[model samples]
Target chain A: MATHGKKQDNRSPADWWLFVLGFVLFAAVGFWATPAILYAEKPQPFQFSHKLHMEQVGEGCQSCHAFREDGSYTGIPSLEKCKECHGEEPMGETPEEKVFSKDYVAKNKPIPWQVYSKQPPCVFFSHAAHVANAGLECASCHGDHGDTEKLRTYEYNRLTGYSRDIWGWSLIPLDGPPKRMKMDDCAKCHRDNGVRDACFVCHK
Target chain B: MSSSASEMRFGMVIDVDKCTGCGACSVACMSENNVGVLPDETDKIRSITWLRVYQIDNGQPYPNTQIAFFPRPCQHCAGSQGHHTPCVSVCPATATDRDPKTGIVSQIPTRCIGCRYCVAACPYHARYFNWYDVPWPEGMDKPLSPFVAPRMRGVVEKCTFCFHRYQRAQNKAFTSGEAMGEMDYQTACTEACPSGAITFGDLNNPEHKVHELKKSPYAFRLLERLHTDTAVYYVSAREWVRRQADNYLSGEKLAKVQAGGGH
Candidate 1:
């Protein structure tokens, strides 16, 4: 009975540190594997520098991403808008511009640029309400995309087909838009702004 | 300027007398909402119809027979003062909600868990559960409206009063820095009615035709005694047609109670 009590008292101090180390190792693997398995990256049609375009344009983002006469946001400028500046020749000496001029411009095919912040088909996001009516800056929701030198790799969730940026880069989302674009972020903004956060407002 | 919940109450005043039961409203609603047409549409139980027309008749013999059509969409029930809309309250997943801004009940099919609690809770039988995925025939999907997402199977769906049109109108108004006009947003059924039986607009706006139409002596909502406080109002000049709007005890007369009208 005394030997048994001693054995119970000196059981290698329960190896509590080893248990914590095991937990940390598993958590590290989870953090690394979650993003790797869930997301698939695809390159944009061609790397385009928004910084260079921003320097050339007068009205900032609106110069290219303008709203239609009927108030609908023209998401990506069509080939016609690009044609207005660059005729049949390459505007810049960059290899990306040369490829754009030869493949998209010369061929008259629309560049299939993958949108990074594309919401699901169920969402009805109104740029008119947010930008025109509320007078919100473009940088409020979309980070420094307009001032970036090159387009970043577009990563999308395999299961939901949503952009990885929608869930944000971190496993645990601790920030709002410009980092995360979840429904909670939208609702938080709406709640803060005294706007109606009805389901039909955003969900058609 | 954006309208608030108290400022706008979008409702419909449908004139039952003028309706010819042509089913044009139903067809337009189906097409506008992208409601799926099953292969065997004759199977009424399986069909998904956002707006359904019901034929009611005065219980009279052949010579005295009179028939009228009631184009029934979702009542968009405002419920009572507490806003306990039957479907909205019973929706466990909050898949359905009555939008305070417009008094329009919205059903988010994606959020719906297919519990069918809302379907059962709705007194109007307006909600329908999609049993099958819509099989769009060759090239038929090309014309599908991009505004409203087509609902998948296992989700309860009902009439939205063509909310997408309202969104578009609001977008136009926001861009132009003006208020949404009375005619800016009209449901497809309202526009498609051959006899102009359906009138839709902000019931709160005096300038809108629906506001005046809803105040007519003949205006009565279906199952009014239930106190659903529905947005849709019906008008019929015929006494028997008005009587059919709600159930009454044998001795109770609609005319006697209607005299104390308070809708």
Candidate 2:
């Protein structure tokens, strides 16, 4: 009985590393597979640089993502907006601009840009309230996308069809807007700011 | 439960005598709110309507009979003490709430779990449960207003007093850096009333018409004794019409009371 107990103790201590190995392996697999399995990526219509456009436009982000006279944000710039700056000729010598000129600009077709921050149909986000009324910076909610040279790959949930930005890029639910934009994040901000967090305020 | 001084109490006061029971208000309410139309809407048990007009008649002999129409919408109850609105309190999912800022009862169908508790708790029968997913006919979905989200089956919906219009008006006000005028926000039914029987505005604002109209001696709310503290009011000179608004004991009678007096 004494020999058996001693043997069991020795085996248990040695096998503790195996349990640690299994846990690490499983956690790593989970961290890798979760995003890959749940999300599907779609490319934007063509490459366009906000950095390049930002240099030429007088009004920062409003020059392209303009608000209508009624205060509604015109989310994506229409083809007519692009026509204001670029005519039949390609603005830049890049192949992307060549494709934009031939396929979209010259054809007068609207670019089917994949929106990264497009919310669910149920959410009624008023840019006028956030931007005009509260005077919130665009970068406050939407990271530094305007400063990026190239558009990032748009990833959306396979089940809900919502952009990954809505749930956020982090697998660990530890961050708020600019990293994640879930309902709780919004409520938290509203609560902190002494804003009315009524359901109808955000939801239609 | 009284609102703070700065809070706006959006309400409506309808002159029942001027209402011809034409149902234009009901029609306008449905289109404005995107209330579904069923193939067999004649089946009142299953049909949904945001604004329902009840036909009431004076119980008089052949030569004296007179009828009046009561266009009923969600009362936007402030409850007995102010915050205990029957439907809002009974909602287990917190799908419905009375907005303290606007005093408008807001129902979020997406958050509703189809419990039907709110539908049963409402004394005014203002809430309706959607039984089926509304199948918009070919080309019918195109004209749907982008402001209001279409509710799916298994949720309760009711009148919002055209809150989306208020949201739009607020957006315009935000842009113009000006306060929202009385005419800036009006419900579709109020605008559609041919006889101008329905007057909608912030009842607390003295500058608006409804603030004064609701104070008339003829004004009364439905089930006032129950103390729902509803935002909607009705005015009728006829004794029978005011009597029909609430239940009374055999010898009991409705006393002449100033509207907005409960607040």
Candidate 3:
């Protein structure tokens, strides 16, 4: 055993330290530098809590988010939709509601809400296929964001400019909520469900 | 996979005799699909035309002069029983496919790798390769149809039979709780034809107008001998016009081809 161990130590002590240093540098870059370079933090237009809205309205998401007759998904609620409720005054005494009513609804201006799950222009996503045809819930891909009381900062890739949700949130990929919205995720889900799709099924 | 009894086979039947060669079909297709206009359209071969009208003549002089216009769409070829269409089978990326349910050859621009294999493989030259970036004029982007996404450079695009309209029609039918039929969905070219020459419908459906129109004695498909099994059929009463549909050998008489009753 001693002879075998000595034979294995064919390199100098300095060589061992250099190898250790290289590994440490690689791990630091991968664990730290990669995430910093890959993601960009941006603030949302306003603090909108879905949980609070759900509690107040006592309705599902489709009430605020409508699917058009043409099968197009009205992703973000239009300002006109907000005007329906906050026509005269703010829904709540909160600062966000006050700002929304005064700056947007009352002034007849549109609120530029930053969309977190926006896909690239090339990708053609059909909300009807997932929600109407497949009978999938909004939470399947979006996680419990609808139940979260506070608005989280939108994280996007610096290079591809895609949402962090597209690449999955965790760098280590521990397999949690907010599953990546990449094509691989779609393919895997389709495979699991045995839903055969042509290339034009989701693409145009 | 087992085919459903309600499977639709969408096809077009164009009456060449009624066509005035106005190029309305081509114009409508381009505008509807948001097909980019090239900076230099002088090079006809390089230019993109989802639905092109080719003028063919009998090569007669003066009084005997005869000319006919052929508006060629993608054809959505359903080659023989087992094989896929020529373009679809040759596509390395599987970007183009014939949807068995609808018999519509669908081209996915996003999945296209721009290899141009399918473009070359196409006999009708239906597929067009995007050589350069689409130069959208000032304020043109805003007017683009939301249903059809503008194709990026380095991809191939062909006639999609206005699939978005089908999706919309399907959605409308679903909402109304009504069954969608051939009349529910029609291509832009078919709708824009001033002469009402083009008849589009589910060829498989016995009740559809196209089913009756396709069986007309005057109907003939382009290059039928190649056995492309094109969905689009042309109808012309003129014997010379029928002869122009496909090639004939020196010994093969026109009477013999007519007896065969369109391949």
Q: DockQ of every model listed?
A: 0.70, 0.47, 0.40
Segments in model 1 whose C-alpha atoms lie over 4 Å from true places: A1-19, B2-6, B81-83, B259-262
Per-residue lDDT of B15-39 in model 1, one digit per residue for the tens?
Answer: 9999999999999998898887888
- RMSD each, Å: 2.4, 3.5, 4.0
Q: RMSD (Cα, Å) of candidate 1?
A: 2.4
Model 1's DockQ?
Answer: 0.70
TM-score of 3: 0.90
| Model 3 Cα lDDT, one tens digit per residue, B140-208 | 898788778899899999998888887777665544456676777999999999999899988888888
The candidate maximizing lDDT is 1
Clash list (residue pairs), candidate 1: none
Where in model 2 is the C-alpha error above 4 Å?
A: A1-24, B1-5, B256-263
Measured on C-alpha atoms, candidate 2 has an lDDT of: 0.87
Candidate 1 is graded, for docking, as medium
Between prediction 2 and prediction 3, the one with superior lDDT is 2
Cα lDDT for residue A11, candidate 2? 67
Which lDDT tens digits does candidate 2 get at residues A79-103?
A: 9998898988987799999999899
Which model is ahead, 2 or 3, in terms of DockQ? Answer: 2
TM score of chain A per candidate: 0.91, 0.89, 0.86
> Which residue runs does candidate 3 get wrong by more than 4 Å?
A1-13, A168-177, B1-3, B255-263
Supply fnat for every model shown. 0.64, 0.58, 0.39
